[model samples]
Target: MSAAPSPAPPRETRQREVISRLLQSAEGPLGVPELHARALNELPRLGVATVYRTLKLLQEQGAAHIVTLDGENLYEASGRGHHHHFSCRQCGRVYTLNTCPVALPAGTVYPGGFVVEAHEVTLYGLCPACAPR
Candidate 1:
């Protein structure tokens, strides 16, 4: 006989829906306050605690990743493949860069015996809109 399928884990329906909307509408990492603010439009009862808890759960499940910048914890959906990020200083907007400029030679090693595996680069600058004319 075939093996039985595993049951799904318990879900927080409203919280999940809120997270879905945030992930879908966001183009970059979103802070909890921003997420809550946007989600509150549709879910009047949405709470800050729910957003935090759901973010934690989603990060644990690899469904989302944390982007820390300027002492703030921002959340973004994962599974987009290898890429870098850029943060605008003036507007405080985060952007995803498709190209990775760092190229290491074969058998390169660090001074502390650390081997390179993967890396994430975050560039800082003024975005087009915020740049001086």
Candidate 2:
């Protein structure tokens, strides 16, 4: 038999570690600029390019995923499990909604035999902090 495949090398660098920690601890998904700015607090010398590269690596490794809101891309750590997102129209902050309201049964089929593999729902409104009483 051929030699066993060698284990993949670790991709975690100081910059990557800082970025990962920020993503993991964030209250919700963050855009690239936001992520970069937050990472600079921990790693002053960190470059935005490094943040983009680290995010790509994380996405490739399935440790992170992207959510598009209001035509902008935001990143969040994976493993949150079957959740959705909400955005505040006033403050432009995105929040994670842990409950799913859609009740589409598994293997949902639509017109033209289209199979629904997955779904994402984004609700738009003012968040609690931004809402007027």
Per-residue alpha-carbon lDDT of candidate 1 for residues 1-133, written as tens digits (9 for 90 to 100):
9989987876668778668667756867888888888888888888899898888888887889888877788888888777777899998888777788788644668899877776778899998889999
Sliding window of 10 residues with minimal summed lDDT for model 1: 100-109
List ranges where model 1 is wrong by over 4 Å: 1-7, 105-107
TM-score of 2: 0.89
Q: Candidate 2, residue 7: CA error in Å? A: 5.9
* Cand. 1 TM to true fold: 0.80
Candidate 1, number of clashes: 0
- Candidate 2 residue 53 Cα shift, in angstroms, is 0.6
lDDT of 2: 0.90
| Residue lDDT tens for model 2, 30-119 | 999999999888888888898999999999889999988878999999999998899899988888899998987669999999998889
Candidates in order: C-alpha RMSD to true structure: 3.2, 1.9
Q: Name the weakest run of 10 consecutive residues (lDDT summed) in model 2.
A: 9-18
